[model samples]
Every structure is written in structure tokens, then in C-alpha cells.
Target chain A: MTGVSGGAGAPRLLQVAGLSAGYSGEDVVHDVSLHVDEGEAVTVIGSNGAGKSTLFRAIMSLVTPSSGTVTFDGNDVTTTATHRITRMGLAYVPAERHLFGDMSVAENLLLGSYPRRPDPERLAMVYDVFPRLAERRNQHARTMSGGEQQMLAVGRALMSKPKLLMLDEPTTGLSPLLATEAYRALAELKAGGLTIVVAEQQVPLALELAQRGYVLENGRFTLEGTTDELADDPEVQRAYLGVA
Target chain B: MISALMDGVVLGLQYGLLGVGLTLIYGLAGVINLAHGQVAVMGAIVVSLAMEADVPAVPAILIGLAAAAVFMLLVDATLMRAVYRQEGESRILLGLLIMLGVGFVIDGVLEWRYPIQQLGLRIGGEPIPILGVPMSTGSLLATAVTVVIGLVLVVFFRSTALGRGVRSVIQDEQGAMLVGIDPARVRTFVFGLSGLLAALVAVTRAMTGPVGVSSTISFTILALIVAVVGGLGSVSGAFAAGVLLGVVDRLSSFYIGTYVTTIILLLCAAITIVARPAGLFGRSH
Candidate 1:
């Protein structure tokens, strides 16, 4: 795991302080606070109902934070629109994948660069990351397998050249081998200095890819530590790592 | 029979233009603008009045088109804004009711001011002979305009970034928003486009034949039928279905009777709904 050198002076890419958000009037995420420094890979590991997704949504401004300040690159963006937040270099990939099923894979990737002219070099980089996507570029997104679709979703986000990429439950329905493949791709991306905030139920993979981990339970972060520390923690192993 | 078929093809093209706007609105915003027909009537009436006031044909048509686009944009900004955040069945129902009320208001004003008058454009040149049939010059001009508009729209959706954004919204609003496309702005632009298409339909209809104030209801019904039969959100489907229905309507009216045309069109719509609820080219939700 990469050491947390950002400690006090390193520039924070995203800072969320006291964020509370939910659907309708019910709060799903309560007073959650976290920060990701530039080039750091952070993971929020939790169960299905632990509000990990909500926390990510709140940070992306997909869900309005009831009371909080989300500072991105020293600018307060708690109340900014989702698209504006995306334009400011924060990209989010939801659990559903949300690929336009009827559209071609290329079209879906191109749409990620919306409100901005698509750069061929960036597109080439996405293609280089996921060679399977390049093979099926002309095919409809619906035709791809689950693993391929997930890759396409990630590739599409990369098209925007986002500085920080937030992913929700990326390995939810994947087989072990496919899940490993996805995590390896993400690990490669992290090595390239892309700051990542991944919310996942897959504890081992998330911990393996992220330098730091946060254990969330019932809309709040129950524990936070370096990946090695959390992996060694008894409670985390018993609950998430499935250690008997 | 050949002439009837040709006439149907021309009318189908016009109906396709009309249905594209409604389909786009439904696809992107999930709203059915019930006042769509009335808006077209408003445009035709404006053109008629303008021509009566000695405005040239080109200028009058342009003015009417502009008026319709502006009016619909205003409607979207003020009235539709109330239901912009709504979703699913409630949003559709609310939009339908609100636009229906708008339609009634517009109809009332038009009737009071214009009376039960029939207005049409005059074709300057002689009718062209094609395949032993005489085609009115005005119909040919209207058909040409319809083709041009349709091509332009195709290019817009295929090539332009804004058009791609609109398509993204239609496919998945949440996904589009995640990528930083404003769904609200896209909806507003779609509403304006819908109005422009409606105005084009009005101009074409007026050129081909006379349009009365009460004709708005028929136009709305026909446009809805065409849109649904083509598949609600598919523009190409709308165009195909429009042309098919147009040909059917003309042929059936020539053989069966004028009164039976509406019944036949409705029956075709019913069949389309029963066989493929998503329309011919629509992706089934």
C-alpha cells in the first residue's frame, strides 16, 4: 500500500466535511466526512445498506448534501450541479453502469466528453486501457457481457480525462476472475496517478487497490486506517473479509 | 391510385416532421405536450394573418415559425417548469393536463379572434404533371421544405455536440447528468424544436390545403397517432409510420370514403400498439 504522504501539506483533491444526504426526506448518509489527496487511491468499504453509494453521490452532487461543504481543489462545490462538478474533473460511475443500451459503444464513450470537445488522444488512452472495448466499439452497449460493460463504463468515464474518478459497487455482480481483472485495471490506473474514490462491498479487492480504507456502517464511517491496518483488524476481517 | 399514393407520400413526410417534435419531447423529457396541435394552429394562423397584412410569403412563414418556437419556449419555462422535476406516470399525466389546458386556452382565443375561417397559401405557378397526374406546385414546395428540414435534423442529431447531448438525455437522463449535460436545458431546447417542427407542419398544411381554427384538434390526434405508431421516442420510426399512415389514409379515403379515413388510421395505431408496444423502431423500456 502507498504511504499517506499527503498528511498535512499535500494538496487535497476533494474534501467533504459533515455531509448528510438522502432520497426524498429520509437521510441515507449522515454526517460523513472524508478527503482524497491528489494521486491517492481511497476506498470506502461497506455492506449494501451502509450508505457508501450515498456518500459518493453526495460528493458528486448527484444527491444534494443537506448540510456540508464539499471543497474540490480549494473551491466549495457542495451546491454545484452534477454536470458542473463533472466538468471540474470529478467523474462518477454508478452501480447500474448506465450505458445507453441502444447506442453504439463508441457513441456512449463519446458522450462522456459532453460539453467539451473530445480529444483523440484521450479516446486513444481509453481504448488502450480496455482493448475489448475497441473491438466492440461499433456494437450496441447492450450486446456486451457484464464484464465488458463495466469496462466500457470505466472507459467512458476516462474519456473525460477526469482527475478524480468515483466508482460505486464496481465489482458487485462479477465473477472472481472478472472481478480481479477489473481491479487490476483500476490498480494500473492508480499507478498512473489518477486519484480514485471507490465505494465497494468487495473488501479484499478494494483494500488491495486502495492505499487507505474506510469502513462505513449505517450511514457513518465506523473505522478508517491504512489498508494493511484494516486488513489486520479483527472486526473488519470477521465482517467483510469473511475470515472464519 | 398512383396520384393518391404520391399524395400520401407527401402528406406522410409532413406528418413525420410533426411527429418528430412530439417524439423528441416525450423521449427526452417524458412529457406529452397536448397543446402541440394548437401550437401549430397558432403558427398557421399567424402566417395567414401576416399574409393578409401584406407580408411576403417567405417573411410570413419565418415569422410564424419564430412565434411558435418562442411561445413554446415560454410555456416550457413557466408552465412545464412546475413538472420538470416529476417522473414516471405522474409527470406524463401532469404534463398532459397542463398542456391540455393550454390547448383549450389557445383554441378559445383563436376561435374568438379568427372565427371559423379556412386559410391557405396561393401557389403562383401551374401544377406539374407527374405519371399522368397533376401535382400542385404548392404541395411540391411544401414537400421539398419537409425533406430539407428532415435532413437538417438528421445532420444535427448525428454531427452536432448539442444533438448528441439531447440523445444522451433521451437514452438516460441520470447518465447524461453524470457526464455534465443539463437535462433541464436539453428539455427546453427540445420543446423549442417541437414548436419549430409544429410550425413547419402548419406551413406545409396551409400550403397544401386550407386549415381552420378547429383543425388543431384533428392535427393533434393525427400527430399523436403517427408518433405512437412510429414508436414514441424514435424519430425515424415516426417518419416511417407517418408515411405509411399517410399512404393508407389517402388510398383508403379514395376507395372507401372520406369519413372512414380517421377510423382506419386509428385502427392502424391500435394494431401497432398491440403488436409492438414500443413502436416499430423504439427500444422497449
Candidate 2:
């Protein structure tokens, strides 16, 4: 909440207040609240099953929130349909990376601009970001390696030119080097003025990319601070930073 | 021998068309529409009544197709609303039961009201010889129409934005939504298209023989088998399976008997399912 104000004049781009969402009418993430201002990079660091995915799903309306509200770019989107929310400039890349397995890489990227024709500049930008996608444009997405598929997922999200991009555990299966490379790309996107919210188990990489972060433990945010503060916190170091 | 093979190819094209309609709807909506063939019969009844009222052949066929399309759109918006609300197995089962009831109602009404009504399109012309077999004008026309429509559908699913959106929904529903493609809209559109394709198959079938109320169940069975063999969601697969099954149907009928041909066809579908559960083109999850 400290960085909810994007400077003095930049309005808050995304705000979630008291959101409690889960599957089967039972709440997994309870009364969670967070906000990311325009052009800011925010991270939610948590262990497995910490409800990070649930929170993001709640924001996207993939799962109905038992209570609370999500406001994006000044609109109440608590009950908005998932596709409608995406159309309103909030793109999400889930941990599963649900790419169309049978379709080619080019088709997957092309579909990212749904209802709107693919913009040449945006397509070029995505290909520039992940050149492997360009090389395998005609190859089926199912055939791509795990790291390549992750790249395609992020590339697809970027194709929409969204105002705020949310990702859940983007480094779930990547090698250490590839995970670092993935963050490097994200860092470049942040440098290019993109607003991002990433939920990650990898605290070091996430802290490096995000300016501020919230530590989520078992469905609630237990701590909130700038990246520097989070990196130095004793609990965060012991639990996530691997610092004895 | 050549004649039977050629006729089989012609019939196979129509089967391909029918399966594609059914396959697409199942892929997108997760519903196996039991009322599909009955709805097609309803459209044929519309065409027959339109022709009785002095409407020309082509316009009457167009009106019938539109009627079927509109009827399906209505069903998708209204009756299928409850079905769409459910998830996974319940969704599919509920849709099946609802559509079955709709089918029974349509069958009862059509049989009671128009017991003898049938659509028979007779294309009067010389039998054109091709590849050593003389082909009837009606068969040729049906084949031509089916081929053109098939090619159009392939291009649509392969190239067009709306078509790709439909495919995207079938492939990964959540991913489709994240990309701003509404699964509901895609389902509705595909439902209407399914109805139209079903009616189109009826019209094409009428070229060879009369399509009456009795043809409804058989049409549904054929569509189901073809769709299953075609992998349930692949358009090109439907056509390929249709063609292969069509040849089998004709050859079996000629060499053995019409009674046994159906059993053999059923066997083919069963074997396809047992051997390759995903059908020929469906990707295994």
C-alpha cells in the first residue's frame, strides 16, 4: 500500500481490497488487499500453496470472489467476465501456460490480439522479445520445450499490449539459467514502462525485478516493503532468501 | 466397382459435412446434441412446406437452412443456458438429456403432423460419365456443393480470425478467455453453424432419396459415428473419416447386404474408439 500512489500525479492502475476467493465455495485466499500503481513492478512472494494463484485468478474473475472488490484502471471488475477483464487492459499468464497445443506458435501469438487484428509493431515487438518464437513460428506449440512455452505464454500476453500484466509462478519448470533469463526479459519490459504483477516462489529473482513486494504466507500478506527492505528482513531471508 | 466407389465418395462428402457440424459443437460446448438430426428434419419440413407454398427450390432450401440456424441459436441462448452453467461431466450429461428430450418432442410432433411429408430434390439431367462410371446429375451437384463447402470451412478454420477464435476456445478455454475471446459467444455461433450444417446435410441427402421423419434417428447415428471417428473436433479429420466410412458403407452394401452394412459401420466406429480413443485427428490430452 505504500507505493499505491504512482508518484504525485500518476493514478493507481490496479487495486484489490479485501478479496477472498477460492474454489468449491470455500475460500483459499482470505481478505487480501494489494495495489500496483501505473508503470510499477510488484511481486507477491510465497511458498507453494500460498494462494498466490488464487488471488490472481480472483482478480481475473476466473474464480468468483467470495467477497471483496477488484478495481482496475478505475473500474470495478469484481464480477466482470474474464475475457472482458482482459479486454480492459489487464492480461494474465497463469502457471499452467495454457497454450493451444495443436496450433502453431504464430497462431497462438496471433490469437493474443483477439477481436482486433494483430498490430504489426506489437507482433514485431513480441518476436523481438523472444526470437526463438520467430524461429519456430510454424512449429506446433505442444512441441516447444518448457522454457520456450513459457516464453510463448509471456509473449502472447504481451501481444495484447495490456496496461498491467500478471503472471503466476512463471519459473515453475525452467532451469536456473533460464529462470534468470526469464527475469531479465521481464526486467527489460519493466524498463520499457510496462506495469507488472508477478507471484513467484523464487524470491531473489522476483525481488530483483520488482520495486516493491508483498510476502504472502498461506493466503494472507504478512509483510509489505520495498525490495531492499524485503531482501534484508530476517524472516524473509530465512524462509525464502536461503540465508541461514 | 468404380460406380460404387464414386457414389461412396459423394456420400462420404456429405457425411464429412455432418460430422464437422457435430464435432465442432461438442468441441466448443462439450455437449453431444441428441436433437441434431431431428432439428435437421425440422428444417427439411420447412423447406417442403415452403415449396408447397410456391417458393422456388433454391429459395426454399435457403429458408430451411436459415430456419434451422435460427432455431439452434434460440436453443443455445435459452435452453442451453442451464447446460452452460454446469461444469465438466454434469454439463455434458445435462446437455445430452435436454437435447434428447428436445429430439423426442420434435420427432413426435413431426411424425404426428406430417406423417408422409418428405423432401426429395431431383436434379434432372444426363448421367455424366467420370472415371468409367456414369454419375447422376444430383449426385454430381451434391458432391460439388459438399466439396466447395468443405474447402471453405477448412480455409475458415485455418485462416480467418473468427474461425481461429472458435478453434482457440476448443483448444484451451481459459487461454481463449485470457486472450479476450468469449467462450459463450463462440459457443453460440458454433451452435448456429452446427444447425445449419445439419440442415445442409439433409438437403444434400434429399438429392439421393427422400428424407422423412424416419431418417432422423439414422441421421443422428451416422453423424455421431462419423464425428467420433473423425476425432470429434477436427474439421479435416471429419472429412477424412467421412470419406473412409462412406466407402466402407457403399462397398459393404454392394457386396453383402444393406442390413449388415450398418452393423459393419458401427463396428468400424467401435474399433476406432477402442484403438484410438481420440479418433484420427484429435490430440490426446
Candidate 3:
């Protein structure tokens, strides 16, 4: 509909206000409000089951929110279906992720743009970012290492030319060195001005990668500020960062 | 013997076409789809009913195929969807029960309306004079349809965006959704296509059956067995298994008897299942 670089001049690509949601008839997310401004890297940090994943699912519309509203690309998409929202230029990466394990890596990435026509330029862009993907393009994604698979997941999302990319955890279960490398790629994307919302258990890595961060505990936002504020705060350090 | 082999080859082609849809359903939705046969049976019923009402054969069969497709969509919405998202054999068994119920209702309706009877729709060649061979034109038509459908499915899955989207949905529903493809809509489209294909194949087989709803159950079960033994998700496997079963069944009928033929084929299928577990070409879930 619009230009390929969808985030250009777009204001507040994703906005979630008072987003309370969960499974059918069972609410887990409570009064969670967050925003991913166009081209701004944001992170939501919390322990497992703190409703971090639920918030992402709610934004993705996998789980319907009973209250509050979600606005994407300046449109009221509170009740929109998951696909329609995604079509609006938001790509979500879940925890278990879908890598088309039996399919070749090229096939997996090729499928990411199924909603739109094939674009050689887009494929080149993804390949350029993740060279490992280009080298193993013919191999099955399942055969790749954890870090490579994560690259595949992110690369696949990028194939859609998304305005906003929401990743649940880009570095979980990765080796320390691999995790650092993953953070570098994520930081590079942030520097390139791709609006992102990443939720992770690895606090120091996430804060280092994200400019603005929210400290979420039990489905509620407790602290919100520049990454430097949270990194230096002893309360956040003891609670999340595990600093001595 | 050559004629029999040729005839068997033609028959096998038909089974391959029918099995493709069955295999796709099992592989993607993880539903056993007991109602799969009812869709085929209904196609024959539609053709017979249309002909009785003065509609031409081709148009009538097309209409029948469309109706079967729609019916499949209905069954998916009402029966298949609930179980597909559930856990284990629970979903499979639930879909089986619902489809079984639908089959019974269709049978009772057909029995009451058409009365049990047999009518044949002949196509292609007349028994070649002096050849002493009875090559069914119907079988030839069946082969042609199967080939076309197979090629079309291949192109669709491999070349088209919509087809890739369907496959993507099957591989990872959640992942596909993130990229703007809804798994539910994909499932509906696939199931509807399956219904249309199964129904078309059923019309080709109508000559030996009472085209009323009563025949739906047996035919659906036959397609299911062929599909399962071939492997649920692989269309090529379904096609191969279906033809393999069809030829063997036809040959056995000549050597033994018609009633004993199905039993022997079933035994072969059971043995295959026991041996491969994932059918012939299917990988694990």
C-alpha cells in the first residue's frame, strides 16, 4: 500500500494502552501500558510468567484482551485479528518459534513473505544482515545452532519488511558468547532505527541493547526510564540484573 | 494380463487423486476426517439428483463438486476445528465421532430418498470390437482427472504464494500468523479444496453404487485407509498408496472374489501401518 520501508515518517508505529488480557474468560495481563515508537528500540524485562509473553500475545492478538485498547500505525486495532494486525506491518517472534524444521532455510525465509509478493531486494537485505542464513540457505533450519536459528527467525520476520518487529526473546537459551553476538545484531537493528519491543530474561544484555526499558513485575510496569537509569538502580539490579 | 495391468494402472491413478486430499487434511489439521468419504458420496448423489432433474452430466458433476466443497467447509467449522487445536488422539477421536454421526445421517437420508440401487455413467472407449477386453472409459476419465489435479497441486504448492502460505501455515501455525497468514483461514481453504477433489473422484465411481447418501460412509472409509497407509501429510504418498491399493484390489477380485478382495487389501494396509507407523512416506508429527 505504502512505501517498502514502512516505518519512514510513521508516528508511534505501535501503541498499547491499559492492555489487560489473557486466555478466554481468564485474565492474566493487568493494566499493562507500553509503547513502541516508530524506529525506537524498547524492551520489557521480567521473569517467566510475569505476563511478558502475554503482553506480546495480546499485541499480536493471539490472546484477546478483555479491556484497554491497542492502536497500530495510528489506527484503532484493538479488536483486529492477529493476521490483519500483522498485515499492518508488525511481525512477532514467539519463544518456541516456527522454523519449518523439515524445510530448507531458504524455504523457511521464502515463506515469511507469503502475505506479499516476492521481492529480491527484501531477500538480499535479510541475507546481507545474516550471512550465516545466506550460506546455509539450502540447509534445514532445524539443523542450525540455537544462535543461527534465532537469526533465521529474525531474518524471516525481516522478510516481511515489517515496520515494527516484536521479539519475545532473541537470546534465551543461547551460550554467553552467542548471546552477546545476538545482542550485537539486535543493537545494530536498533541503531538502524527499526522499532522493536523485545522481552527477555537476560536483563543486562537486553538493557545494553535497548535504549528505553520497562521493568515489569507480575504483569505490571514498576519502573520506566532510559536504559542507563535501570542499569544503575540497585533495586532493579538486585531484583532483575543479579548484580553483586 | 496386460489389459488387467493397464486397467490396474488407471484405477491406481484414481486412488492417488482421492488420497491427496485425505493426506493433506491429516498432515495439517491433524484430524482423521471421517466425513472425508461423505463428501465423495455426496458428489455422486448430487450428480444423480442433478441428472434426474435434467441437468447435464459435466455441469451436474461440477455442481456436485462445489456442493461437496461447501459441505466440507461446514463440517470443518462444526466438527474438525474444535478437535484440531486440542491435544493428542482426543481431537482425532472427536472429529471421527462427529464425522461418523454425519455419515449416519447422510446414509439414512439417502436410503429414504433414492432407495438402494446401482447406476453406471460410462465414458471413453466402447469395448473394442474383437479385443475381448472391457476397458472402462470411466477409469480413463479417472486417470486424466488425477493427473491434472496432481500437477495443479504441485504447481500451487511449489510456485504460488497462496500455496506457500498454506504450507507455511501447516509447518508452523503460530509462525505463519506472525507473518500475516491466518492458520484458520488456510485450514478452511484446504479442507474445502479436499472436499471438491474427493467429490469429483466420487462421481467417476458412481456407476457401481447407488448415488444416494448411503454410499458415503464406505467410500470415505476406503479413502481414509488408503490415505493413512500412504501417510497422512504427503500427497504423493496418498496418490501412490491409493493406486497401489486400487490395482491390488482389482487383481485380487479376479483371482479370488470381490468380497475377499477388500479384506486382503485391508490386511496389506494394516501390515504396512505396523511396519512403517508413519505410513509409507510420512515423517513423524
Provide the overall lDDT of each model, using Cα atoms, as 2-decimal numbers.
0.88, 0.93, 0.79
Write one digit per residue (lDDT tens) for candidate 2, span B176-215: 9999999999999999999999999999999988998999
The reply for model 1, stretches above 4 Å from the true place, is A1-8, B116-118
lDDT of 1 by residue, A189-231 (tens): 9888889999989899999999788899999988887888999
- Backbone clash pairs for candidate 3 read B12-B243, B16-B239, B37-B220, B120-B207
What is the C-alpha DockQ of each candidate? 0.80, 0.91, 0.62
What is the alpha-carbon lDDT of model 1 when measured against the actual structure? 0.88
Q: Model 1, B173: alpha-carbon shift in Å?
A: 0.4
Which clashing pairs does model 1 show? A83-B180
Worst 10 residues of 1 chain A by lDDT: A1-10
Provide the clashing-pair count of each candidate structure.
1, 0, 4
lDDT of 2: 0.93
Docking class of 2: high
Per-candidate TM-scores read 0.97, 0.98, 0.89
Best by TM-score: 2
Q: Candidate 2 lDDT, tens digit per residue, A112-226?
A: 9988999999999999989999999999999999999999999999999999999999999999999998999999898888999999999999999998899999899999988
Ranking by TM-score: 2, 1, 3
What RMSD does model 3 have?
A: 4.3
Residue A136, candidate 3: Cα error in Å is: 2.4
Docking class of 3: medium
Question: Which is the leading candidate under lDDT?
Answer: 2
The interface root mean square deviation of candidate 3 comes to 1.3
